[model samples]
Target: MLDPLRLAVGTLTALPVSPPGRIDRRVAGRAMLLAPIAVVPLAVVAGVVLWAGHALGLPSLAVAGVAVGAVALGSRGLHLDGLADTADGLGASYDRERALDIMRRGDSGPTGVATLVLVLIVQCGAMAVAGPATGAAAVLAGRCVLSLCCARGVPSARPEGLGATVAGSVRIPLAVLVFLLAAGLSCLLPGLPWWRGPVAVAVAYAAAGLLLWRCTRRLGGITGDVLGACVETATAAALLALA
Candidate 1:
């Protein structure tokens, strides 16, 4: 359990954690279950930064940029890489084989570059006018997509790699429980009205679900890139909804 938690935080965030040399599928799957644990600190930091920025009399737009910058720095832009790759893969080809090949090519295509820029713009813009709580809730809502992406029965696009091992990490019951808890917690974030918290979470879930379905049809299954895209998409959508 500790190993999964460590691996989850270590892999997802810039925070220091000594991960095990060998991570089995069970461990990887559990890592997904604990993914939200990794997100809490990032959300808190962003929220605090937003609050501090407001108190310091910084412009709301500047505060929004700083909040986005904080999470991007902390996450090492890991998920953004995925978003770019997935976009490149999907946009470059209609054939599954070719799309998957393009994704692994490690070069950003026009689509990937364009999407990355656009999504970042949307996220930053939304966070700009959002309250501290809304900023925090948006972060949590985005992270909540992790549970859905790693839920049981989701298949990997490839036979091996990060996606295969982490696919179906948590069973439906546990995933559902996590989603509910995360959803409930999201409401506590300040910018949005009481009802918007669940709405924000739903936006993330809808984004994740939409990505999963599209990837399954286009790429044959989910890849690490796809998962990355899921988080990025959810983050954008949740922030917009919350904003």
Candidate 2:
């Protein structure tokens, strides 16, 4: 468990967690179960950054930007990079091979740049208007979607990579449990309008479902990049629900 926890924290964030000498798919798979636990502190750090910016007499928009920067710094912008790559992959060509090649190029295309800009703008606007509670809920909701993307029977886009290692790592029951816990947490976010949490969570799930179907068909399976895109897309969906 410690190895997996370390893997989860280390792989997902810039946090220093000494990884094992050898990492196998099983370790990566089991780590997905504990991914949310690692995300707890990440979300708290972002929330505190937002709070601090507000306390320092910053405007809501500025505070939202700072909070976004804080989370990106903490996580080393890996998810954001994933979002960019996924968009580039999906947009470069409808053909799976060409799209995957573009993603592997690791350079942002017009579509990737445009998608990232839109996502960031939307996220910042939502956080500015909705405040910290909504941010917290969105974080929780975003982490929950990872469980769905990595659940049993989900195929990996690459034969050997993070996607292959973690995909199908989680059992159906555990995946369902984690996702439900996230949805319930969304419904219980403190200081939020009662309607905000449920609506956000529901919309997040719907958005994820759509992504899963589309990506599976187009990419032939989910990839690490797709999961990253899912986090951002679903986070925006959840936050927009609050808005």
Candidate 3:
């Protein structure tokens, strides 16, 4: 069995994993199982940093902004790249295949840049308005929802993309269990209402479902970048709704 902790950390961080050991199919499958488990600490660290900055009379907004950006770097540009790629893909006026092709390219077009800027601006503003506790809850809940997509949704426009490697490998029940546990933890955080966590989770899932449906119609499946965009979009939406 793969070490759940290593799998979780490896998935969350951009660290290089030794080939064969890290890229083993079994390890990838197990990573899907462990990714949600990894999100909790990332959320906690973000929350604590923002909360501490607030309590210390630092500009909470600035502190939270920097903290969010800092954590994003640690994730090795995963979701942000997703955001950019998805934007380019969706914004393209070409056919679906051509759009997907555009996304596969490493270059970012105007749409991708705009989408990234917009998402960051909205997230930063929402976090500033909602304060640390609520922002943390929203972010954590959003990530849990994203992890569910990776665990459950069909991946990729092809049979061999990153999405396909892990698609449907995650047990549905395990995803639910992790989500519930994360929601409970979010509620336990000071100053956050229990209802807020569930509500945010619900919203995030609903939004993800809509995106999944749309993607399916357009590309016949979800790509890793699509999953990233879903999380980023859902997180921003949840935070904005709470704010």
Candidate 4:
């Protein structure tokens, strides 16, 4: 059996996968099953930092902002990259293929930059108001929803890239299992009302689903960057709604 941690790390990070192990259908499906496992530590660390900041007399807003930035760094700015690429692709008046070409380019355009700023601003503002537990939950929920997007929409798009490679390989049941696990983890937050966490997760998933549908309609599927974008956008939306 493949180590779940290895698959999770390989999938979540841009770190080099030694030997570039073959990701078959079962492996891809299993990878989705493991994605949420990665989120558990991330959520825990963010929550601890937020709580520690409050306990240490640090301004909640400052702490929240730093916490957000820290989490972003841990993910290696993967979602930010996605958010920018998706914005560029969506804003481009060129054909979908050309827009995708623009997105694939390593440069960020005005629209992309603006979208990134807007997302961070909203996320920070929400975190400041909602306090740490809710904010952390929102972030975790958003990550889970993004994983769902990879398991569902991206795979079906059959695009000629990462989306295609991973999507068709995973099974739906395993994907759902991962989402449930992530949701369960979100509920573990102390002082966070039980119902609220699940409700927040549902909202995040709904928003992500709609956004993914729109992106698929426009571009016929999602890219790795688009997946990252979905996570950030959904997380922001969830935080705003919770706030």
Candidate 5:
């Protein structure tokens, strides 16, 4: 249990944590399932920043932007990098090998840059309208989608890196359970109508699933970058739905 927790935190955020003593599919599965829980520190930090921004009478959009930036910093911008790489992969030549090569590159291209800018804008705008509680919920929902990405039938696009370590490691039942629990809890988000929470979660998953399907078709399967793209996409969608 502790190893799973450590793996989740160590991978998902910049927060310091000891690496798990051993890592196999079982550990990776549990880590993906625990992603939301492990990211609680990051979420809490975002919540505090959002609260403080409002308390100081800052412009809601500006505050939301700061909060979003804070989360990116907390995660060491790994997800954002993933998002950019995924975008570049998708927009690159349709040849699977070529696209994968582009995604594996260290630099971002024009398409990746544009996609990142648009997604961040949407995230910040929606967060401004959704308020602090929903903002935090959106962030958690973002990570919760990772479990779904690792469900048993999913395959890794490549045989190495973080993707292969966790891809297809999660049991379908466990992944579905994590997703359902996240959706159910969304109904409890403060200041939101009961319907909005679940709807927001649903919207988030739908957006992520679309991306998952596209990536699977275009790139042969999921990669670490695809997982990151799903997180950011779901976060933006959830915030939009809540707003």
Candidate 6:
């Protein structure tokens, strides 16, 4: 359990932790499933930022931006880079090799830059309207998609890299169970309409599913970048629905 937790924290956040001694499918699967729990500290940071902003009478937009930035920093901006790379890959060309090559270059292009800007705007703006609790929920919602992405049978786009290591690591049942748990918890969060939490989650999943389908068709399968892209996409959709 501690090994899985350590793997999750080490991979998902910039927080310091001892690396797991072994990383097999079992450990990776458990780590992905534990993604939401692992990100709790980062979520708390976001919540605190929002709460502090409100208490200090700071501009909601500015505070929300800061909170989003804080999470990006906490996670080492891996998701944001993934989002950009995925966008670049999808927009680059229909040829799978060409698209993958573009993503491999590790530099943002016009399409990637534009996508990042638009997504960040959506995230920050949505956070401003959603308040502290919902904002934190949004953060967890982002990581929850990691389980779904790694569910058994989801192939990797490449033979190596983070995506290949974790791809198809999680069982489908386990992924569904995590989704249900996340939905239930979201619904139970205080101060929001009962429907809001579940609806937000549903929307996030729907958006992520669409992106996954597109990536499977376009890039051949999920990559590390694709997983990151899903995280950002789900986070934004969840926040928007909550707002």
lDDT of 2 at 38: 77
Question: lDDT of all the models against the reference?
Answer: 0.85, 0.81, 0.71, 0.72, 0.91, 0.93
lDDT of 1 by residue, 47-163 (tens): 999989989999888889999999988888888999999999989889989999999987898999999999999998999988787887777677767778878888888998888
Clashes of 2: 0
Tell me how far the alpha carbon of residue 206 in candidate 4 is from the true structure, in angstroms, after superposition: 1.3
Task: Summarize candidate 4's per-residue lDDT along 106-213 as a digit string, tens digits.
Answer: 689999999999889988877776766777777677767645676643544434666665564555676677567756765775666766666677778887888788
Compared with the true structure, what per-residue lDDT tens digits does model 5 show for residues 1-243?
A: 999999999999999999999999999999999999998888887888889999899899999989999999999999999999999989988999999999998599999999999999999988887677888999999999999899888889999988899989999898889878988888888887888988988898999999999999998889999999999999999989988
Model 3 whole-model lDDT (C-alpha atoms): 0.71
TM-scores of all candidate predictions against the true structure: 0.95, 0.93, 0.85, 0.86, 0.98, 0.98
lDDT of 3 by residue, 1-243 (tens): 445447656656655543334465466656665665566666666777777887788875688687678658767778889889988988895488888888889689999999999988888877776666677677666666655665655556657777676666666787778677866665665555667766666777777678767776787677778878887888887777667
Error of 2 at 102 (Å): 0.6
Off by over 4 Å in 2: none
Clashes of 4: 1
Distance (Å) between predicted and true CA of 239, model 1?
A: 0.9
> Which residue pairs in candidate 2 collide?
none
User: How does candidate 4 fare on TM-score?
Assistant: 0.86
TM-score of 3: 0.85
Clashing pairs in 6: none
Better of 5 and 6 by lDDT: 6
Local distance difference test, candidate 5: 0.91
What would the per-residue lDDT of candidate 2 be over residues 1-243, giving only the tens digit for each residue? 888888888877888778756677678777777777877777887688777777787888888888777777877888888899998888878999998888878789889999999999998898887667678668767767787888888898889777888888888898888877776666677777666687788788789878877888888888888888888888888878877
Q: Model 4 segments beyond 4 Å from truth?
A: 1-4, 13-21, 152-159, 180-188
